[model samples]
Structure formats: C-alpha cells, structure tokens
Target: MRTRQRWPILVAATLLVAACGQESETPDVDQNAVATTSCASSGELTMWERSGGNKAMVDMLVEAWNTKNPDCKIKLTYIPHTEMVGKIAQGIASGEVPDLMGMDLIYAPQFEKAQQLVDLTDRIKDWPELKTASKGHMTVATFEDRLYGVPLYADVSALFYNKDLFQRAGLDPNKPPTSLPELRAYADKITALGGDVKGYYLPGNCAGCNIFTVGPLMWASGAKIEAANKGDEPLVGDGVKQVLQFTRDMVKAGNVHDGDRAENGETFHLQFGSGKVGMMGTGNFNITLAREQNPKMNFGVALLPGMTAGSSASFIGGDLVVVPKGSKRVADAVNVMKFLLSDDVQVEVYAKALNLTTRSDMVNNKYFQAEPLVQDVAKALEVGRTPYTLTFFEQINSPQGPWLKMLQRAYYSDDSLDTIISDAKKEMKAIADQS
Candidate 1:
C-alpha cells in the first residue's frame, strides 16, 4: 500500500506548534506565537508506497491522522513495486529520503543493512498492541536483532477454481482439489474439454508470483533452497526438482499456455475469466480483478494442494512501513505506526482495501470472515512461509535469476527437466554466494 499525494501543509504546521509549545514553560509567549512559529518552520512528513488500487486506504488513514492531530501534515508519493528499491536507494544516497515509506518485506533487509532505516524494536517492544500483531510477518521486518518496520498488509497464495468448469468436467463444484494428485487429475479432466480451454494457467514471466504459487509445489514435496556452512555450495533439493518437473509436465500437457502471447503480459485471471483456463493459483487480490472482469463467472477458492511429504505451504508477501534514519519525525512516525496497528484502523483499512490483515487477532474479524476466498487466504497465512532470507527478492527478480529463467525454459523451450534443474542449481549457488 503506497501513495503519491502531496504532503498536507496544514498538518505539518499543527504538529510543529504542538512539538515546540508542549515543552514551553514561558507565560510571556502567546499560544498564537507558538502556532505561527511552528507552522512557518515545520517540515512535511513525506511517505512513499506502491501504486496499486489501495491508494484509497492510505488516503483514509491519512485523513484519520489529520482529524486526530490537525497540526501534523503528511506528504504521500507513489512508487511502482518495480522501481521502489532503485528510487529509495537514490533518495537515500542524496540525503533527501522521505521520513516514512512502505517497503516489501523481502527488500527490507537491504535497507536495514545500508543503515538507512530507523530501529523500531524498542517502541514495538513497549507497545503491547504491536507485540500481539502478526508475529509471522513482523519476523520479516526484524533484522540483526532490531525491528526496522511494521507490516501493513498480509498476502498469501491460494487455489482459485472455476466452479462452472469443474461441474462441466463432471467434478463436484463444492469440493475443490485438496491434494496434489487430485489437482492434477482435475486439471486433466478440465483440459479434455478442448475448445481453446486450459486446465490451469500461471504466467511464465512472473517470477515472484511463481515463487508464491508454484514454489509451494516444491515445498509440498519437501524440497528447499539448500543452505550450507562456510564455502559449501548451496543446492536445490529433491522436492525442488520434483516441482520444476511438474511445471514442465503441465506445459507439455497443454494444460497451460506457454506461448509468447502469454509471456507478453497475459494474466492468469484473463485466461480464467474468458473460460480458457479452469483454475489458477493466485493471491486474494486476484479475486477483485476476476470479479470485475467477469461478473457472471462462477469460482471458488481453496487451500493449495498438499504434497505427500509436505503440507500445503504458500508464500506470504506484503508491505512494511519504515522510518528512515535521522528522520526529524521519528517519534511521530512511531505514533502513526502504532495507530495503523490499532484494531479499529486495521479493520477499517483492511475492510475497504480487501487486503489480508497482519494482526493475528484481526484474522477472524467479521470483515474478513464475510468473504469465503478471503477467509481461505487468512487461513493460508497461518501456514505460509516467506523466502528464507531477505536476499530472496534480488535472487529471484534479477535478470540472471534461476526462478524466472527456469520457468521460461520450462514453458517456452524443449529443455529437459534435468538440464533446467542443473542450470537452476548453478544460478541459485551464485545468488547464495553473493549473499
């Protein structure tokens, strides 16, 4: 959740006045002098966030802040997820960074290492409200024994199926696939329909999404990115190979699309919406887009299929709010963080934005329970895992990343499972070494 709106000048002036006069013991200085002086000198709190459909939620929070603290002003900026890291790095180097900003959990460690983020550990420890918040997500925000940010949203992947397509394939619409074998069987049945239709669809170009959705397939098989001591080479385990081969099988079976058209921005939702795909692995956000695109389509969501060795474990992704080092408004930013974590605001913002809540206590809040898919996503959060380390973002997103290339080769080329996996291990080793 990020924004691009300009800072509120009035709010800054108000905060400045409160900061200056709250410490004054002089009876000679008029309150108006405090207000005017503070207004004239107070700087705006600039914040940067991702530009999605969640702008309204940020606006509502800022509005609420202004209502409660009329003197503090906030400036908002919107940065796309793709450019957030680069822009923030440039801003930090120039000493012109914002007071507050939203960062992805995967990339937060880099900022923390750069010494550009404020340590919120003390505040978080003292604040009971934040302590009981989403401990799972907060784990990502904490690094090197200090908390650097507060998670703002929770996102987890789940299986979304076309109920109508399931019924057409002679499957029960009410019973979604719950295991890997069952999912594969259902996909085969759906593909048998044959007229421009697919059993499943996942974008070959989406490395991050694949990690969130397809990565689970490997985890379900009990494989992981191997970690080793000293100079030992990290390797992909058996489960990793199994999932990679599974993806290869899906592409070869005509159950999924792998052409250049799919590579050029064709989303899984579009294929599912058009009745060309019967099922997809997606996050909760996809539900909104799918409903908007095809109101008449019948769909149901369920937990990702479990593997023989591994339980269903999806990847969790979300944004975190951080205070920059040396920010003049560190105290105020902490206050805002606490407010955002408050039960009332968390519920309000999550209710309107349709994003999952990071607070454990808020998981069963009435708002989330009202929607079936959202409820499934909330449950998925209980069992989800993030990439093992912060470097996971760069490792997977870089041009030479193993995940993207592995996915592409599997989908677009005739490379065998062995070759693709051998190449992936080398790439993963390089990434681990760099880290």
Candidate 2:
C-alpha cells in the first residue's frame, strides 16, 4: 500500500496529541498481559477498511465471520484511501473511533509508534502461525518488539511480461528475465520486433508506482534504504544508482513506452494490457485489472530481479488488522482478528478469491496450488520486505517527495545519475532526521 494521501504536519501533530491524551485515561497495559478474548466471544465490533479491490474480499470475509459466529457480529465501514487518515484522526480526537481498523500496513508504524494502537505482543507472541506470517507486514506492525496488528491481505510487487510478445520476438515464454542484464536483453529483443510494441513500460509521474515497483530492485541488490533500527540513520545505498542507470538506459534506447513520462498511475497498466508493451513492473493487484482491460492478452509474472543473477525481491504491501486503542470492544475485536487469521477463513475466503493470504503457510492451499502465478506471489510474500520508517509518505510516497524527484530527473532527463542520487540522499536524510 502505497497511497497518494500525504499526511500534513497539522494532522500528524493532532494524531500524536490525541493518542497521547487517550493514553492518560487508560491504565498502562502490562507488557505480559494477554487478552481474554476467544474466537467465539459474543458481541458486536465496529471496523473500518479502505475502499478498493480488497473491499469485496473484506465484505465476503465479514459475512463469513458473521455466519460462523451469529452471536458475534461486525459492522464494517468502507472509507476512501484519501480520507482514511484524516477520519481516523477525527475519530480519535472526538472519541468516536472504531473498535478495530484494517489499515494500510505502511501506516502501521506511525500509529504504533504514536500509541494509537493496542499492543498485542502477549496475545500473539506464542501463536504457532505467527512464525509463518508475512515478515514484512509483521515488521511494520511491530513497535519496540511489541506486535500491534495482524496482516489482513498481501500485495507484493513483481515483473509482468507479455507472454505472446515474447514468443513473437523468438524469446522463450517459459523463461522470463531473472536479472537486470537479462531484463535489458529481453527488452532489446522485444523492441526489435518493430511496431508500437516496446520492450517495457514505466509510470514515470506516479511516485507510488515507482516506490511500489522499483523499490524492490534496490532491495534485491542488498541495499537498505530505510534504517533497520530506530536510532540508526537511513541510507540510500549504491544500488539506487544501479536502478536509475538501468531505467535511464532503457529509456534512452527507446525500449520504453513514450507515454510513460506522462503516466500518473491512472492508466498505468493500460499500455501493457493493450499487448503493446512486452514487460512492466507493478503490484499483484494489476493481474486482475490488466486482465479486465484486455481479456485476451497473455501475461506472465516473476519476482523483480537485482543487479546480479539469482537475486530477487518484492515490495511486500497490504492491509493490517489492528485494534485501535481506547475501544470498549477490545475483547470482541481481538476475537474477530483471531478468527480471520485462522486457516479456515484464510484459505476459504481469501485464497479461494484469488487474493494472497496474509499467512505464508497458506501458500500451498488448493487455490494457490492451481495457479502458478499465485505460487510466485506466495514465494514473494515469504521473502519480500517493506520499510518500517515513520515518515514513509513524506519520504517516498508523496508526489513532491525526494524519491519521485530523483526518479524523474534520472529517468526522464539527461542529468547525471550521480548528482541526482546525491541530492536525493541529502533530502531523504533531512526528512528522516526530522522524524
């Protein structure tokens, strides 16, 4: 979940104050205290989740949960992604917060660090399934070694290639690019087919698109963009230049779609979906969207590769099921979360619907066993990573952020890659320091 909503300073300050103020009225929770809620607890709990493709899955799961536990029901509200943060802030300030919320995992660190979420370390620490859950989501939800949320679903990034185009270009459709040099070589071969078909596509103007799709390339090369620990300074490593140079070379060689520089993510997959672009990097959500755009188009997916061969990674992104602090229905909310994470719901409701399960252990379920693309995604869920920084939006996802600026200069201009990376690093360092 990369979203366009950048939290302003005022709202951030409001959330800090509201969360801290609520903490005063509520007694400090014992670090070892375990919640008494069971999966069968009978009560009503309110929850909020963002509206999008996941809405159908969420609604279906809630209905199933209600059917399973007639005595314990959930009232879920669908809020727009742009309005979620502000609404949550207002809810906290007015004491009108929901019992639980399924929020973007990227924002979990912010809420957890600010004490806006309930600590569930004691309750979830001993659960066997926790060992197999997606590490990226769990890492984002944890603050100071305490768990605050459970993964709701997974959205990982991967390279999508047009299978038909590969065959037409005399390339093996069964074997996709596994490394950066292979990707460039594949692109050159595809571009030589001559026509509107280019070798690759890029959403040049969308910051979210770049971070979600390109971030993993840097990570796969063993680069750490965000600090692993709170007190450590975040560093933009040399792998960034490798990614920038690769993209710039592709663009200069006319291997990328000409319209890519103007794409703002609204039609990110359309060019590739039209069967004109040979490959593109995007999230798992696009598998459905692209198919819907052109039902006859043939595509294949693989984990995005690093600079070297045999290296692969993905940006692990999705929603987390969190119990907001100050809720009277904590027991019921915890019970609902537990029920959702169970094997039955995870397999039947989520995997059956072609959605990635939050738990990696469910990858071998019948649904994933039937789809090879999903199997690749399952592997990504197991190894993909996400930044746990508190200023993710300001530093990476914002339209005016340093990450986007760096991409624009490096990919769309003739500017020196070294200078672009250096300037961006200073800007990122300043933002991280302020946080």
Candidate 3:
C-alpha cells in the first residue's frame, strides 16, 4: 500500500508482443527459451525492486547471493514504487524487462493475465520451503490455478496507538480498543485532552491510506470492495456502511485532526510519529520508523478492529518477486528467490529489522518475540487479505478513481450514505466488468 505512483493502463497490444517476442534473426534472444524448474549452473541476472523500507532488505539479499555464488550475480536496481508498474510496462514494450522484478501484489493478476510473467507453478509447487510462505500473498500471485511469483516481504495495515497519550488521558495504556464502539470512545477520550492533540488521524486525501487501513474494518465485518470472481459485482455489505458511518461519526465528533481532510500519505506517518495523534491506521513498516523518529514514544500495535469486539483483519499489502516472461535468466532469478525465502534471510535479516517475514512459520522467531509491536503486526499479517482483481490499480489505487471519489463523499461530503454506497457499487462493477 506504500505504492503511490499513478500507472497507465497496460496497453494490451504491447503486452501481447512482449510475451511473444518479434521474429528477429538476432541471437540475443532464444525464441524457444521457456521457464523451467531447473536452475542455471551460472548466469548474470538483473532485478528491479521498489524503493523505500524494502530497499535495504533487497540489497542485503543480493549481496549475500553474490557472495554465495559469484557466477550468478544479480544486478539490482531501485525503482520508486510509484513508477514501478509504468516502468515495467514500458520495459515489456521495449523488450527490456528485468529477469527478476519485485512488484506490488495488487498488480500480479494484471501482469499474470497479460502473459507477461513466467509461470513458476511447477518449480515451486513441490518445494518444501513453499509451505512456509505467506498464504495470503501466494493467493494473489496465482492466476487460473497457476503460480507466477512468491512473497518478497509483507506490509499489512494495523491499528497504531500512542501509549503515552493513552496514559495521560487516564486510559489504560495496555488496553487498546477492540471494536467500533470502543474505538470511538477511545478517540473521544483522547481528543478531550485538547491543544494540538488529536484522538485519531487518517490521510483523508490518500486513497492508499484509506483502502489499506480503513478497508480492514469492512473486511473484518464481512464486506468487500472488489469482487473475488471476474465479472462479479462487489459485495458492499452492512460492514461497508458501518465502517463508513463510523468514520463519518468520528469526523462529526471532531475526534479526527482538522488538517487530516487535506493531508495525503506523504507525511501522515510523521504526524503520528510526532506523538500528538492517539491512534492511526497504517502499515507495519512504520513500526521501525516511529522509533527512529521519536525514540521515547511508547506505542502499541494491534489488528484493525471490526464492527464487533472479537473480530479483526488487516490489509495484506507487499511486493511479490516475479520472473518476467522474456527473461533469459529465469532459473538464475528463481534461485535468488529461493535464497531469499530461506530461513537465514527471512528470520535473521527481515525479522531482525522489525519487519514481517514472508513466511508465517518464522513469525515467532527471537527477533519478533522480543518486540511486542512487531509481534502484533506479525499476527495481523497472517489474517490479512489482499483484494484480487486485475483492475485494482485503476479502480482503487488511482487517486482520481471512483473508489477515492466514493470514500471522499462518504466522509467529507453531504451526500446520503445510501447514495454514496449505491454509486460506488455501480462504478466498481463497471470497472470490474471491463477486466
């Protein structure tokens, strides 16, 4: 969900040509080369990764791989997450795609369906290590019962609370809200503190912020913003209305920051990190960032609550490592993926950095156990879900898309809730059908 770039529609014609290269007589590409389960004995590899928190982790893995096998060295390039999809699309069009690419999971279906990703179903299906990977990400990486990628790292949304704010407000620091009613009550209590302090904060102008954070509330209560099956309409259940109403109520109560309505995600986390906000909905990457920004700030993390007390969910947002269709070093790229998934990297590297590992079994490692905040997020990642749709970027992640329009109207506008929901379903349905 940290991905903020606007991506253009992947030209269907360009992808078709990229998947099946031109009939050039040049020897650079082998027309008959195809993805295989076997690993190359030696080769050079090029991989493009998204920048941000994940950059250091990718760099470490690449260095380790190069040290282990100098013959199969990987040349890594950092691309802004915002520019990743469009750049990849352009790369495909120019027949210059990377051998390995770490992409946002939401775009997996789009590329997989376009035949621009290499199928690794047979390669990883029986690999014993595959059983330990995040099942949620694996679901997003699959299309038509075939695998195209593996989880590179995970970033799921959860509720972040300021412990000091809670204690100063006379609320128990250890006890965070677990339901919609409790959340509102907590927000009101915190907001009562007055003077530059706010009970809750959300990047009102950020579609990714709302969807990755607010979306879990709807999902925990059994609602959906996108259809699971292609061509089906989105199921905007009572949960959806309830979540929207909850946000509207919070706004009306002045429990949210006055400036939040105009704030985008660019500095939302920093505001929370400043120690004024009582609660915020954001991703796990902030766990380390919050500490770095304010070393003394006592914070707690928990799953995003549902309408009721006992239910919770999170947005399973992260990058997936995929080998492009025309990659000449598919085997070498996959070998890198395997090395990354190994426990040595998943636990020692990622978990030690206060990040969630792609493998669920590694959640209880020594590093996570030592940090309750990280542990709580690890639990959220297991139960989180990523929306499965080819039009995810266009219909939801896009700033100008209908999803943001509906979300804006739901919270800030004077429109009726019924009208907002109705219009949203229609717009989402139209986009879903286009896929």
Candidate 4:
C-alpha cells in the first residue's frame, strides 16, 4: 500500500506525512561475511523505515530482530515516511546510507535506475514466502524482469462506512453498496439523516491521497491508467472521466465534510478517526487506528464500489524493504528479509495488528477470516493492481505532479468533464514521455 495507503505526513513543506516508529542506529565497517545470504552468523545491520501508522508494529519486529539475533545486531531509525525515500536518494549521492530501507514500492524503479539499490532477483528466489507475495506488491519493486525489493507488507483501499450511520439510515449494515451509483445513493441517504456527520469523506485536494481514494474507482471501472509500470500515457478513458464526474456531482451535493476541499487526505484520517465522516476510501491499517481513536465508533468495510455492480478493484500498497548498494551487509539484509517474511512475524501483522500482509498465502489465515474489515482488504488484494509505471515518478506522486493537478481540477474546477480529461491526458502523456 505504498502509494495507495494514507501515511501521516510529518513534514509540512513536502508530502511528508505518515504515522511511524522510532529505533537505534548502527555503523559502517567491512562486513566480510556479507556474501552469505543466510542467517547463521551475526553482523551489524543498519536499516531505515518510514515513520507513522505501522511504526509500533515495525518497532516490535525490530526489537525482536535485535534480541533474537543479538550477534546480527540490526539497528534501525524511523525516517518520516515523506522523508525516507527522498533522503535515501540523497544519501546515495552523499555516500551515507543504511544497509536496508523499508521503502514505498512506487519509488523502487527510480532507485534501481539510480543504481542505489542492490537487485535481489537471485537472492529473492531462494525465499519460499516470496511465492505468496501479491502481484500488486511485486509490481512496485519489479523493473523489466528483476526484483529489487522484498515487500514487507501490503495495503489495499476499501469502502469504509460508519455502521451506526448505516443503521440509522435504514440501510443494511451487513450489505454495502458495490457500484458507484449505489455508493452515491447511500451517501445521499446518510446525509439526509441530518447531524454533524457527513455521508462521505471526499477529497477536494491532495492528489497524493487520491492515488487510492478515487484511483480505485477508475480501476474498478475497467480503466487502465496505463500499462502496469510503463506506457506512452495513462489511458484517461471514459471510465476515468466518469469517476471524476461522479466525485464532482457528489461534491455539488455536499455529501463530503465541510472543509474537505481545502485540505489534503491527512485531515480525513482525523475526521474518520473521530467519526465525523461516514464513508471514506481507506487502507486496511486504518481499521486499528479508527478503533483506538474512537472506541465507540462502529465501522464496516466493503469493496470500493465499481462502475458495474459486483465488480471489484483496489490499489495495493505498502512498504518494500530494499538493500541500498552501499551497504556492506547485504547478506544480513537477506536474513532480515527471511525473518520478516516468516510465519511468526506475518501472523502477528495479520492476526494482531489487523494489517494486510504482503504474502497472499496469509489471505486464508483465521485472523482475517474472523475480521470482516481485514477480510475486505484481502478480497481487494486478490483483484487489486498498483498504479505504478517505470516512468514519471515525479509527475504522478509529486505535490505539483500532473496527476494531482488533474485531480485538483477534476474535483474543484468549473470545466466540463470532457475538457478536463482531454487536458489531463495531454499533460500525463507529456510528462510520461520525458527522459
């Protein structure tokens, strides 16, 4: 859920927002045994992970890593999720880097292009857990035919609704809308039951969040924004425009929060967490945060509504841990990967943390089977795809990127839908064609 999940942004100047964890540090020395990609011996390993939502869980694992293999002595530091990737790219040039980086999948290709990460294609095949990794998770880190990162966990977007609101509106809590028109109707129904609560949490700004928010709608509509990781341009077809138009109509209906247009997605987390919003397109991780934030709030999750009833799609996102080329402990990093992908660690993530695991094999775990919200995520992942391509990283994810700009206009502009789609397709293709 790299691009698709909501990370609490820490830095105001950049898109640096995400919930994270804190940790210890390590040193640089000649790691003579680094050639052994096995976990038999010990060596100092340094790693950097993004901070926010998943921080505590990750910290728990890191603590276990240090204690379980004291000789390996792996030390970690939490970089603001916003700062992790950019800083690491800078670190590559400055020659100051960590042994491993738990990074967003969308950026892997860029690092690979810069020669900042070590390709684990050969080393990765040796790991059995890899076969369980989902296509969306692997799609982010794969460039051409090689893998550069091991997905630590996964995130998928879903339609999250306030069960209380649904019941009050006379809607069935067990049954959620599965098409865009039905979703719109539900939003209107919830809104009609006047209160401080809004029917839907729509984003007027923040393209960074929309990658999964509205992005899922486009995918569900059978729109191919582009080829998996490379293409001449994103296919801004009728489906994409319909999604934008649907949002526009909803915004016109005042189904969203009062100040939704002015803020980026970061605010929705607080709103949804507090029970002010009824429905929001969100990742699996938010299930825990919502409960912790408002224990009284009852929530239900379902597949994001598609264009056609029963049709489903979601954007899979999450961090992929990669080894930077400068790190001497490549072997130790492999060991770290081994432990991370193990049943002990992943089971905790799915069962206790209620977060999505990168391994598809965990889909049937009794934990997810028991939790409806987590199950919604698993179902989404089974059919989910990542909105990544090997090109135009800046124009897509950047604050000033073309994709965000298109969304900004789509949600806020007075222009016609056809005009917006036409202009957006041109801009996207222009940026995509860049070197």
lDDT of 1 at 82: 55
What TM-score, to 2 decimals, does candidate 3 have? Answer: 0.92
Give the range of the ten consecutive residues with the poorest summed lDDT in model 2: 23-32
Listed in order, each prediction's TM-score against the native is 0.82, 0.93, 0.92, 0.86
**lDDT tens string, model 4, 173-289?**
878898999999999999888877788887666665777778888888877664333346575566888888888888878898768887665565566787777788977778888
Superposed by TM-score, candidate 1 places the C-alpha of residue 187 at a distance from the truth, in angstroms, of 0.4
Residue 23 lDDT, candidate 3, scale 0-100: 26
lDDT of 1 by residue, 1-435 (tens): 111121222232233333323221211222122111122224566788876535666777777665666566777788875566666665555455676887766667656655667766765666666655655567767777888888767667778899989989999999987777677788999999888778887677666567777776776667775332123344456777666666667777788854522442334435556656787877777788788888998898877765562367677777788976545566666667877887777777775466677776677767767776676677776667666453464456544467678777876678786888788777667655655
Ranking by TM-score: 2, 3, 4, 1
Identify the runs in model 3 with alpha carbons over 4 angstroms from their true place: 10-39, 80-82, 228-230
- Local lDDT at 430 for model 3: 83
Worst 10 residues of 4 by lDDT: 15-24
Q: Write the residue-wise lDDT of candidate 2 on 108-174 in tens digits.
A: 8777777878887776788777788888998888899999888888888888899999999999998
Indicate which candidate wins on TM-score.
Answer: 2
| Candidate 3: tens digits of C-alpha lDDT, residues 232-290 | 87846899889889999889898888888987677866777888899988888888889
User: Model 4, residue 430: displacement in angstroms?
Assistant: 1.2
Stretches off by above 4 angstroms in model 2 are 2-6, 24-40, 227-235
Looking at model 3, residue 320 earns an lDDT score of: 92
Candidate 4 Cα lDDT to native: 0.71
> What stretches of model 1 exceed 4 Å from their correct place?
1-44, 80-83, 129-132, 226-235, 258-261, 264-269, 388-390, 412-416
